[model samples]
Target chain A: MKVNELVQKLELEVLCEGESFFSDIDGCFAGDLLSLAMSNVRAGNVWITVQTNMNILGIASLTEASCTIVANGMNIPDAVIEKAKDENICLLRSEKGMYELCLSVGELI
Target chain B: MNSFKVQYTIDGEDFSVAGEASRKLKKVLQSLGVDPQIIRKATVAMYEGEINMVIHADGGVIDAEITPEKIHLFLRDKGPGIPDIALAMTEGFSTASDNVRELGFGAGMGLPNMEKYTDYMNIITEIGVGTTIEMIVNTSLS
Candidate 1:
């Protein structure tokens, strides 16, 4: 699935350039724990996390994650959005909780 | 075997800048044409270590040595050290305060996850002297 598809399916607000999600996504892993996500998620997997901290962006960049979906209607911090834009990483904000986002997107990818 | 080394001072002031060293190393490893899996493992493991140092120890020093067979990471911090290595290694046990947990870490999985993905790990510390962690990820599994 492409990141754009995830954006559409979840009805997420694209805080940054929505076109970047056109990149291919290989899998999906949803976790609030950054360490677990880093160890478990593949490079092109879309990471679904509830974290709004700046460190999350660094983790996403290091793992070369395809995109990040901040679940549970969390306010996407300006710093995080800025980092994502600079790194060309797709950042999406969803009002849906982690479980629902996973269930909805899991079936697709 | 050819050898390479890089040392970085993790800045204690900026939490957002914690993973700088690991990020740079990942790029270098990729440019050197290191195996993808090896690069991922090393980068993930080291990145976790770097974050741990910043969050728990108020930053520290990271020494990395790249060779034909493996990548070695030495992370040493001057902050208060762990009292019990065993308790700290448990998946859900954390010494991090509630404030740190709010930052999305302090989940008590740092050491365990570090050990899980690396080939070998050793943690040395004293009550007040600080902690020194050594982690090695083999490029080729034996």
Candidate 2:
């Protein structure tokens, strides 16, 4: 499914809609460990993590993930949000936990 | 053949800028027409090393030498060196504090991930003195 369609279907809160929001999403990979996620997540995968730090943005951009869903309603610092905008990374947030979001994203993509 | 070089001194106290060097290196590799997968492997490796510098070493200097055949990363730090390289190399081993964990790092995956993503990696460290790491990623110029 497309990034926008998946976001709509899952009812994700759009913290920032980057250019990739209009791109296609192929799979879902959920992990909070930056290094592992960096290694495992592929291009166009929607990464599910509770990490709201700046490194997540770097990982998201490096891996070129479709979008990163910060689950569990984690509070993302403004600095991180600004970094996301500057990098043009598609970052989303969800009230739901990682497991639930993964299921939803898995089904859609 | 002449190689492209990029260097950055990571601010050990700053979390936001830890991976800046890797990001720049990735862009340089991209502009030079490096392979996508090669770029991914090189950047990931470089980023992990860069973060490691900021976290464990209190910041360090990272130099990237980019050539058609490969990319070499040399990281140097004056932070307390590793006492047990073997234990540190094991997965799920980290000396980082609880604060670092909340940021989604310090899972003990950085070093292993560096080795995993690089073609060659070497470390020279002395406790209370400093540590230096060298990693290389082979690329396809053709």
Candidate 1's TM-score reads: 0.93
DockQ each: 0.77, 0.81
lDDT of each: 0.85, 0.88
* Clashing pairs for predicted structure model 1, backbone only: none
True-vs-predicted CA distance for residue B44, candidate 2, Å = 1.0
Per-residue lDDT of A9-108 in model 2, one digit per residue for the tens? 9898998899899999978789988888989899999999998888898889889899999999999999888878888999999999988987777766
Cα TM-score per model: 0.93, 0.95
Per-residue CA lDDT of model 1 for B1-142, tens digit only, reads: 5788989899877888888888999988887778988998888888888888888888999999999988999999998999889989989998788888888788888888889879999999998889999999998855
Error of 1 at B123 (Å): 1.6
Candidate 2 stretches greater than 4 Å from native:
none
lDDT of 2 by residue, B1-142 (tens): 4688888888999887788788888888889988899999998888888888888889989888987678888999999999999899999999988998878889999999999988899999999999999998898634
Enumerate residue pairs that collide in model 2. Answer: none
Q: State the lDDT of candidate 1 residue by residue for A32-91, as single tens digits.
A: 877777787788888899998888877777777788888988987788788778867678
Q: Give the Å error, residue B3, model 1.
A: 1.3
Q: Best candidate per lDDT, number?
A: 2
- CAPRI class of candidate 2: high
